[model samples]
Target: MELITTVIALGGVARCTSLYAAGFSKYRIALAVAAGELVRVRRVWVATPDADPFLVAAARDGVVLTCVTQARRLGLWVLSDPVPHVAAKPHAGGIRVTKAHVHWAAPLLPRHPNALVDPMENVLALVAACVPFEQALAVWESALRRHTVERGALERLPLGGRARRLLTLANPFADSGLESFVLPRLRWLDLPIVPQAWIAGHRVDFLIGQRLVLQIDGGHHVGAQREADIAHDAELMLLGYHVIRVGYRDVVENWPRVQDLIQRAVAQGLHLAR
Candidate 1:
């Protein structure tokens, strides 16, 4: 039962040998497979019948899920999920599935032979290496927000140029990937920026300068949350604070326009509560 639980916990599938470390023998695990209690993913892997399709496919393809795919599976805020990203050692030899986005780089830390899901460290490292800076920063901030790995621990690893730079910029206090994406871009404004800051009885996404509030709303579109956000904007305006509210698309897809708006607000001296 313990081995069965462990496999499911590991994204619903894991190598058979890993259960051995938990006191289950190959014979016992095989017996469970025969008894219809577990599905034999292959000669060496076992899973519940309801394992994730991606993990099953990764297991079959002999690749580890990494980058945005892994981050999304870990419940992080990913900008989009167009392709299933997988990784293999730089020279893992011929792979069955070459159609998917495959990263041929070896992980900073070694991956086990049976790991269907990449470790958080490997996922972040790949994300930093492969994705654009803005997208990568969002994932890094997401990992920090979830406490999957800490900056101190990541610093201990021998990270390369980009990963090392990303580690330095990572802030766990960031509440969302949007906050992660927005704050760094606006640093050129030469003013203080505080994220997840309490203002007007609610936590604004960012408080720039003395009174300029920047908010990035999620993609939920209109509902109770939107109404609440509108009320908060009103409250902030009444309090002599300038509020710049933009949707998720504005931050991700139309950032130039959003930046222009912010720049105009700053030029107007609206950031200061005169």
Candidate 2:
């Protein structure tokens, strides 16, 4: 019972060496395995029945789950959840490479011999290299918002190229990944865009200039939420603000039309305080 409890405490999965280091005798480990208290993973690791499948697979393949894969696991927003993105040591050999994006760069921090997940620093670096610019920035901002990694700590690292550039643009104010997407596309307009700005007792997604409020309805905008947003838009208009409400598809799939709408609004000085 104690052995099973210890395994569960060790994140439901642990290397055999870690277990031994914790003072479990080899005979006790064998007995636990034989009694079905633990399941052996590829001879070196053992896991409880309810271990995270992703971590289990990482252990089996001798890789650390990193990049967008780890980002999603950390509750940071990712544009998409594709196949697993795992990291292996640059010189690692005989790894199981099947249906997963393998990152072979040296990690920014040393990985523990028994670790199944990459450090947050390494995850951010890999995300910068793996995904497109906007997508990577969204993930980075999400990390900042979640306090998964400190912005100063990330900046202090000896980052280069894309990672450094993305850090420069990454801010913690985005309410959603969609906000991350919208602000950068409109940055070239040389207008001030404040995200999650408070106005008229509610928060707008993006406030461009002084009076233009952009509201983004993400997946959670439905039924009462939709009605409430409509009410807020009405209130804003009555108070002399222009509201441009957009859906996920509008901002994502049909962005050109959305940009045109904003440009027309700005052309008429709608963004200016009336």
Top model number, lDDT:
2
Model 1 residue 255 CA deviation (Å) reads 1.3
Each candidate's number of clashing pairs is 0, 0
Worst 10 contiguous positions by lDDT, candidate 2: 1-10
CA shift of 56, model 2, Å: 0.8
Q: Per-residue lDDT tens digits of candidate 1, residues 163-208?
A: 9989899888888888888888988888998889998688998998
Positional deviation of residue 179's Cα in model 2 after best superposition, in angstroms:
0.4
Query: How well is each residue in 173-259 modelled by candidate 2, as lDDT tens digits?
Result: 889998889988998989999989999999999899999999988999999999999999999999999999999999779999889
Give per-model TM-scores. Answer: 0.87, 0.97
Q: CA lDDT of 216 in candidate 1?
A: 84
